[model samples]
Each structure stands twice: as structure tokens, then as C-alpha cells.
Target: MKRKYTAAAAVTVVATLSLAACSGGSSDQPSATADNKPVTLTMSTWNLANSPEFKTLADGFHAAHPNVTIELKDYDAAQYATLLTADLAAGTAPDILTMKNVTDMVTFASGGQLQDVSDVKLQSGIKGAASYKLDGKQYAIPYRIDGNVIYYNKDLFKAAGVPDPDGSWTWDDYTAAAEKLKTGLKTAGSAALPAYLHGWNALVQNFATAQVPASALKGDFGYMKPYYEQALKMQDGGLQLPFATVTANKTTYQAEFGKQQAAMEIMGTWYVATLLQQQAQGAADKFAWGMAPVPQRTSKTAGTSNTPITYGDPTGFAINVKTDQAKTAAAKQFLAYAESQEAALTLAKIGITPALTDDAVVKVYFGQSGIPSDDLTKFAWAKQKIDPQNPPSPKTATLNTVLSAMHSAIMTGSESIDKAISDAEAQYKNQVG
Candidate 1:
């Protein structure tokens, strides 16, 4: 499965853009229809055995066009960047490569490895589509959008007599709730911590940028100081696990929340599938949990009527530049099919958030078994404005690297918040300028 929490840590790859001598061959097989020729297109995916979205797209597209077959090439999810970089450099990459984020997409496009898919008919509701555009041409089409939300254990909240979040929560409200939960759980002799803040740079830095314009990230990250200060305060108060413990023990947000060790966790929508599957398989304790809108910076963007801002980079598909015309045509067809409403419904049934969302898609998504049926959960899931966690820019890779180190320094108390932010700004300016 794609653990989106760690997506911000993707390696920055600089590869040579040499064309491959050999390309995918088209076959005139018996399965070919009169209008469509028989062809097999190889697509790159990670954790193929667990990620059903890719299989669903491949199957759905193949059913529509019997002449084409999509063969998935799996890579290690954690080492996807390294493996894909090697493949691209060696001219062995699959015909269709999955663009995990805009940063890597920018890199691949800059290296001339991604073909322009500007003509692909994207659904009107597709999010983060503009981030895939490079030099006024579309290079990829987003298939899935995983926005951030706060998942809280409803049973834990009830047990502690703490009111459940109702979609209008500012950061102050969130912090107060955590403090109350900490005291209430301790008084009740429950071992669950108030919240779980995962040790990802994106958790703090990306949330800080959610309400700002994408251009604000270009040469400045001074906006991250307040978010970092709040995170450090939470860690100091023991409301959440410390960064050192989480990093040293390699603890995951899944185990922390699924095992009832934490009452609340702010994570991407992708966790819905994993949590539901884990509950059904008896890997997680049976608990009533619901997703609420992520806490806002202030009241201006908070409430059900207002769209809560969250951060997540859309996952898109791009055709390799080295592929032949027959395979390229087939790949484009697959990309268009991925943005269809039929594809949206298929993904919703499995709890994956598809890019093409509408009333019907929202209905199907909430209709799934084990999914939270509350109005608040539905509102949070359906009414979010997702911004690219890392916008597309040649300088983004360097900025991400510097900010990650800055996060570690601040959270671990090795450097003051101002000092860390200042250092990161200087480092980015020196490297990018």
C-alpha cells in the first residue's frame, strides 16, 4: 500500500534522459477487437499485492478495451524512488510510470522522461491537476487524491466524556481537546495517549502551507515556525510521543492508533482502507472511530460551511517517453479511463479516495462496510480543499531536504524553533539561488 505519510521523504533523483533502443511491441492477438489492436502496456506500481486501486483500473480499462492488457511491475514502496530512478536511467522503466508526487514528476519531466498528456480528458473534479503541468503542458493525470484528516477513536472520546470533534476545530481547540483527553484517560485508568503525531516533516511543514498559496513555498518557509512551535509544545507536555522515541523505535502511526495506544491521529485518507482491512482481519481492536476535518489555522477556514484546508499531493500516472506509438495510445486510453466516474466508484468501494469525486462517488464511499457513517465524517471526507503538500518546482527537492532536517532539529530540541527555521531558510537560499 502507498503510505502517503512518508511521501514527503521521497529521494530527489537526477537522471540522464537517454532513449531506450528497445520499445514495447504490439501484438495482433485473437482478443483484439476490429477497431482496437492487441497490445500490452507495462505500468509501475508499488506493493501491487496490497494496492487494489491499480488492479481495479487495469481490470476496468481492459474490460472496456479487450485488446489492451496492463501488466503491473511492482517495486518496494519504501525504495520506489531509488528503484524507479535506476530503471529510468537504465532505460528499463515500465511503459507507464506512477508519479507519486509533483517533486519527482518535475524531476522526470525536466529530464525528458515523461510524455505530455495534455489532451487527456480529465474529470472536472480532479484535484491537483495543475501541479502536474510543466511548461504549460500536462505531463500526467491524477488518479487518486489523499487529503489529510483527523481520525479519532469515538469510543475513547465517549469513555473520557470528551465531546467529539464536529468539523469546526481550530488548532487551539485541538490542543485543548488533547489536554482534556490526557487527563480524562489517566483518571479512568486508560493507557491511551491523547494523540499521535507521526514523525514526518510533512505533518508539520505541509500543514503550515495548506492555507497559503503554492507560490509561497518558492523561496520562503518562515511560515513554518508557528506550526513547529505547537508541535514541540505537544511533545514536551507528553500529549503525544516524542520524536526521538518514534524515530529510534521506528514506531508507525498504524500500530499507534490501530492498537488503541492513541486516541487521535491526523493522517491521510489512504489510512481508511488499511484501518478497515485491519479491523476486518482482527489485526486491530474493534473500536468506533470517525474522521473529522483537520484543525484549521483559525476560524476563517474552520466549520462545515467552510472548506477545511489540508495537504496531500495527488498520485498520478504518466507515460514513458521511450514507449512506442501503439503502447502510448493504449496508455493514454488507460489514463482517460482512470478519470472516469466508473473508475471513481470502483476506487470508492475499496475506501481509496479517487480524484473524480461527485455526489454519487461520495455516496458509494460512505456506503462501504466499516466506514464511519456520521454526518461529520462524511462532511470532512467530502468537503476538503487539498493543496499539494510539495508544489512542483526544480528547487522543491532541495527545500524538502532542508526542511526535513529542520523539523528533526526542532522536534528533538537540538535547536530552537527560530534557529532551525532561520538555518533552513539560509540553506535553501544558498542551494537554490
Candidate 2:
């Protein structure tokens, strides 16, 4: 979901890299296999190298195919695509890669950079398997699904005298809870924040996204206005950290919450891995952490009705089109086993949901003894459809930057919200044009 190429210059760079991707050959010829020959396949992903899931994928793949080796090269999500583009241009691209979302997969597919996975019969009835399909053709395999969830500190909430959130909470409840939590922070004589909002969209757009179908390129910026102004109120009320301070310190939601400096953070389910890893390292066990759904929109909006809706997509892996015959065949075998029901169970054990969203598997994942009994991972599996209408936009990355900058300007007192919005629209047109 992190689109790093949101700046105009970055967009130009992405376009250039895409051209190079287009230069690669599109060989639909079936890859030949050599089961007896030793084969190595590399998959570039943004998951941390220390994550147990990567080990599971590699171990599972290697155990099944004794002659094949799966090497996982990990990167920070922010730098993943930029660094990967370099590797692709240098002819050192990994045999397989995990795109941020369908957007990246589609971009690579359109450029002829990804292998056509049509021959591979994917698991039907899986939540996000078709996310990488374009024009009825498949390009990548959907491996996992991630969406927004509110992670709160149980200790902080108890200390603040605020009640724990329930499944059926709304935006009104969220604001009230935030205010009470702020008071509690002041009462505790702690300068720590009550709520932490990071990333461009998470801070301002999630509310709108939950209420309606919206995207940076084609979305109505006005719907986001209420939250933008609320951000100002939160900053003034000391409920949220100022944008200036956040930018200066380069603080992250994980660090803020893990350090016990923030009471709650609304973020994607992918954080389950970060939190789980930290707990294994005993980094965040001091204060109990729990998950809840994001506040639902109480009212309906354009093309959507109010419910516990949140933003998310099925993110997964794609293979390089230029993979050699033997390597391609090996990669396909690895992908098939890696995204199967067994692999989904493996991911669930660690608090991540695979694209193959099976309720029984998800229930077992949450029922693990170590994790909190009331974890938010299960809420992500609740019966609700993902935002299917908001498809990938070619200029979304660039326009995302524009809106993010606008939010910053208002929060920093550098510009009025209305003026900022006007300016952002102008910039979006200029940059995207």
C-alpha cells in the first residue's frame, strides 16, 4: 500500500524503469523442468528477513522440492520498489518478487516485466486471487491479504479510564475515546500521545475510504475535509503528535506504540508481523497490545453505505518474465506450494492472513495461546467485502504525494486547509498532466 513514487520526479523515474521492463521479452513458452538438477529461485519482498513466514516459505518450498532452493531477499517497504527497479535494469532481478499491491503488479505486467501465470490454476474462492489479473489474463499469484485495523494499548486504555472498543463502534465513538484518552494521558503526567497516525493516507483518507470508494487520482478531496480539520483539532488538543515534530523525528507508528509513547494506532494488518516479531524479541510486552476495527462511518456516502468498512487489497508475488526455462518452471512450482492452504496456515500462525482467507484457518491463527484472545486479526476476516471499485490509478502515486503535502502544510500552520486543497488540486493536475 506504500506508494513511494508519489513525487513527480519519482513518477518520471518509475516511467523510465517501466520502459526498461517493457524491453524484456514476453515468452509465453512453457518453462521446462529438471527435477533432478539443483535450481535456486530468489524472491524479493518487503517482509523483514527475520520474519518466520519467509522461513516457512523457504523451508516449505525446499522440503517439498529437494533440488530447489528459495532465497528471500528482503527490503524495507519504502525502498523496496525503487531498489528492485535498479536490480531489474541491471539484469539482476530476482526470479520472483512481491509487489506492494495489484498496482505494482499491473504496472510490471503492462511493461512485460512479469511472467504470465495463466497456466497455473489458482485456488478458487480465495479472497484476493484475481487481484493480479488484467484483461482476463493472470500475471501474478495473490499470496496474502492486508487491511486496516486499530491497534490499541490495553494498559493505556485501562489507565485512561476509557472503555475498550467493540466490533460495532463508529467515528463518533472514536472521537470520544480519543478525547478521553488524551485527558488520561495528561492525568498520567505523560507527554506521550493518545493516537498516532502515520503514512499519507492513513492519517486523513481512511475515514473517507471506509465511507466510500475513493482514490487519489479520481477521489473527491472534499470528503476528506472533515478528518483534515479534525487533525488540526487533535494536534491542538495534544491528542495527536504535530506533523512538524513527526517529520523532524521521523518517528514511526511501530516505534511510538512499542515505546509506550502512544495509546493507539490505526494501521494495516501487515503490522501483525511487526508486533509479533517485537513480542518475540520482548520489545512490546511491557504494555499489553490488542487490536480492534477502525471506527465505522455512521452515514453512507457516494457508492457506499456505512458499515465497518476499511481499506485494503490482496498483495502477492509475481515472477520475472525473463526467467530462464528451468528457473521459470521451478519458480512456478514454488509459487503454487507457497500460496497453498498449508502455507496460508503457516502465515496465520504468526498473525498474518493469506489471500486464501479460510475462516477455520483464521480462527486457529487467532486462537493461538500466546496472542491476546481478542486480537484484531479475526475482525479482518469478518464478513465484509474489500474496496473493489478503487482500482489502481496510473497517477495515484504522484497525486498521493500532492495530498500528503497538503495535509502537512495545514498541520504545520503553513497553509489554510482550503487553500491547501486548492493548491493540491492544482499540483495534482500539473504533476499528473
- Top candidate on TM-score is 1
Candidate 2 per-residue lDDT over residues 108-155, each given as its tens digit: 777778888887778765656656777677877766776677788888
TM-score of each: 0.91, 0.80
How high is the lDDT of residue 173 in model 2? Answer: 69
Candidate 1 collision pairs? none
Per-candidate RMSD vs. true structure? 6.6, 8.1
Residue-level lDDT of model 1, residues 9-99, one tens digit each, is 3222212122222121112112233457678788888766567778877777666666676777777777787889889999999999998
Query: So what's the TM-score on candidate 1?
Result: 0.91
| lDDT (CA) per prediction | 0.83, 0.67
Error of 2 at 288 (Å): 2.7
Show where candidate 1 strays beyond 4 Å: 1-34, 213-216
Model 1 lDDT, residue 41, Cα: 85
Question: Once model 2 is optimally superposed onto the true structure by TM-score, how far is the C-alpha of residue 375 displaced, in angstroms?
Answer: 7.1
